[model samples]
Target: MKPSDPEFQEFAEAANLPLLRTARLLTGDWHLGQDLLQVTLTKVYLRWSQADRWDSPTGYARTVMVNTYCTWHRRRWRHELPRERLPDRAGERDTADTVATTDALARALADLPRRQRAAVVLRYYDDLSVEQAARALQCPPGTVMSLTFRALARLRQSADLHDTAVEGR
Candidate 1:
């Protein structure tokens, strides 16, 4: 089938939800996720004529999304306001403990280096194997494994510190 044929539409329809989910997890924000996906899809559509020759169209789009996301903050700042503490406890539907833990995890994720964050999201959250992530990242499988390992270790340390701080309160 031609790359721009109906198959592309079908594939896009099937991929949308999973791609959006991955984007949201990668970005830690829904709005940014949508923007990321939009950019990815636009790029893919522009290259649709080559889709017939791609080893994996889905993989190409995923790699494009990640590369685009990584570059976004480089050219300009998104103007996120950084604060040491929230002025008020928002998103309070959950128990205080759950909310605290979730908040700490989000902060820890934001603090991770971009490559490490990508490794963690692709490996754990997106459930990609080391080999698959390596392909997406254009790196050796060993590198992907190392990146994920370090990311996980850092996350564990962050969690431990958060736990200790809570206990002291």
Candidate 2:
């Protein structure tokens, strides 16, 4: 219930990377991912009392992110065009191939529909179970499976992603 609790700060630090990565995948841009994570964290902070009682606050935060993204989808004005250049990375990569692969994947993911993107990220990236993903998406388990199937199929078929190595889970 404490807004400035040390426990909550520790939890936030531990969850930041995974949450940010999931947000990045969901939004198809690092900047949008930062915003998504900030919004989700703000919501969690506002409900600190309830969140502190949870056994899995990271999962709850992720659910909030998915829900927020879905809410954003319904708002026409929230959609924006992609930027031509990516933001600078904090560290230099040792290899060019790694950069190319990730760039291709990001572009491919950006082309996917929102639900498809969410489904893929939740089910694969987050390694959530079908039921878990379904709950996060507020849909039936069957629907989650369907979305995952369609999303993977689309990703597999994408010409931009054709040359990139994909590992199916």
lDDT of 2 by residue, 1-169 (tens): 3446677788789999999999989987777788899999889878877865665788788888999886775322246667799778745656566777888888888788888899999998999999889878878999999988998899889887777664321
Each candidate: RMSD: 5.0, 5.3
Candidate maximizing lDDT: 2
**Shift of residue 18 alpha carbon in model 2, Å:** 1.0
10 residues in a row with least lDDT, candidate 2: 73-82
Off by over 4 Å in 2: 1-4, 52-55, 73-94, 163-169
Q: State TM-scores per candidate.
A: 0.78, 0.77
Winner by TM-score: 1
